[model samples]
Target: MCTVCGCGTSHDHDHGHDHAHGHSHGELHFGHGPAGAQVAGMSQARLIEIETDILSKNDRFAAANRQVLQARGAFAVNLVSSPGSGKTTLLCKTIEALGDQPLAVIEGDQQTANDAERIRATGAQAVQINTGKGCHLDAHMVGHAMEHLDIAPGSVLFIENVGNLVCPAGFDLGEDCKVAVLSVTEGEDKPLKYPDMFTVSKLALLNKTDLAPHCDVDLDLYEANLRRVNPGIEVLRLSARTGEGMREWIAWLRGNLGRKVPQAAE
Candidate 1:
């Protein structure tokens, strides 16, 4: 089992592993570890040690992936969100808006090649990575996917991470920046609920705005909560279905493109 997310390490099984046995409280409580996750028959200290080891190995691969992108002068962004946040739709629209500018997509899902096919239909190069039981895409997986892609110099690579808000936040995939996508239908308090995801993201897109009025969502509150979680995160309200705010979204992408990602401090 993965110490970080408590899911099976193999990708051929279900993504989330639900350990039925909870604490003696008759409910599941995962507060047993510094890592905030618990696995049966594992001590908190042991879990922390294993998680550190996993992340350290992942970081090495991430550094290598970053070096490869930097050498090609390519910019990469890891798009993360929960399922049904319209992340794939946003990517397809972004691909169309960027018409001729070099672009490629890395689609990460627990199963199926649907999203990758959607990206390819936009006439952009795409690679699909299916992590069957893995909760999120790791640096090693992204590194392998890059090998199958013909990423152009100065191109923009959008890595659409598996639909997950928790696990993906802790794993860096060597992207220049992380972008958080939240649907208005998902509630305005999402930023507060998933603080780590918003905190690590460079930009937050409040997607599916076309349904905001019908959904009775408070867009202002969402922006306020996002700012509360990440003071410097750029927030944009856009509906990929309606093409609302896409120009600004596209412009933001262009502005960030070609900028070198800084190396992590030791």
Candidate 2:
């Protein structure tokens, strides 16, 4: 098993990641040693080597998956968010809102198929990959999932990654961009806390607008914090529950699709 995300004894499977859509390509999981890191006699270099090796293999799979998706003319978007950031709700909203676009979902979860079931409810083709104790989804799983899923060319492919803010940031599943989601119930300083995840993300979605007034969140500070970590990050505030800012979010999604995704009628 790989040391980083608990990848040693694994089986290939697919499950909904909610936003992670956590799927198992060949045996990928993103968790540490139970509760902590195993750092007794291992040197930093050894740990780095193990990480590098694991990432290297994953990157290769990601690249291959990218090529296949791109060849089919699909634009892949990787959604990264902490668990319960309303990722699945946002996805469900997006699927219904898009209306006519060709969209496929790859759900990555530790074991449940719930996310995929929800996406399928929207009449979109979806596959679920069960990570089996994995905290994040890897490229090998995605590549294999593409073979099983019937996503069309010129479509938008959404990879709902395994739902950890930390581990998923490091693995690239050949996605065009990483979209990060933040909830109002969380602290505004989350960007500062998870700098790497925010730094690598191209866009940030500030979700749960319906609860903003009731919560003690500082929206201004939140945006400022995001900028502090990623100077060029673009942010959109929306509530998947109420459909607020859905147009903007949809437009952004279209804009990312090489400016080809159709605009939904208001």
Candidate 3:
């Protein structure tokens, strides 16, 4: 079990070959301990220790990934959101807008290559990772994906993490920043309800705003709550389908990417 988020650690990678990664994924049985009695069998201190160890190891891997990207002058952003937030649509639109910009994508999901295929349809290089029971993608998994993903020098890389609001917030997958994609339909209190995700995000994209009028949601309240958690987070309200506010989103991407890969942004 992944003590960081209590999610399953087993993975069903998209790659064909088998290689060993130094992950501390041990088989954790919840019931039927000593004397045929059901028990959790672990103390709070032990749990904390395990969590620390896991995060520490993950940080090491993240640092290595960061170094490689830096050496290649590649800018990476980790886009995270809950399911059905229109993230894929926004990503596809962004790819379309960029046109000839050197870009690659790392798509993460628990099953199927559907999203990766969508990205490929846009003519951008993409690698899909299927994490069978894993709730989030760790640095180790991303580092492996990078091996197969031909990230170009002075290009932008987008890592679309597993559609999870909680687990993905804690794991740093060597991205330059984390962008939280929240649909206006998801409710205004989402930032308050999931503060960790908002707090960790550098930017929050309020997507599908074209439906805000239909949903009777308060856009101001959403922004207010997002600021209550992450005062420094930049928010962009956009509709991927209608092309509304996409220019600003594209500008933000260029500005951020320029910090690392100036030619790609240009």
- Each model's TM-score? 0.88, 0.84, 0.85
Better of 2 and 3 by lDDT: 3
**lDDT tens per residue, model 2, 1-266:** 34442357333333422121246786533324332234334443445556777888888998898777767767788999999999998999999998998889999999889999998998999999999977888898888898888877678999998788888888899988899988988899999988989999999999998999999989999999999999999999999989999999999887777543332111
TM-score for candidate 1, please give it: 0.88
Candidates 1 and 2, the one with greater TM-score: 1
Candidate 1 C-alpha lDDT tens digits along 150-212: 988788999999988888898878998999999999998999888989999999999999998
**Candidates ranked, most accurate by lDDT first:** 1, 3, 2
Residue 131, candidate 2: Cα error in Å is: 0.4
Judging by lDDT against the true structure, name the best candidate.
1
Pairs that collide, model 3: none
Least well predicted 10-residue stretch by lDDT in candidate 1: 9-18
Cα displacement (Å) at residue 163, model 3: 0.7
TM-score winner between 1 and 3, please give it.
1
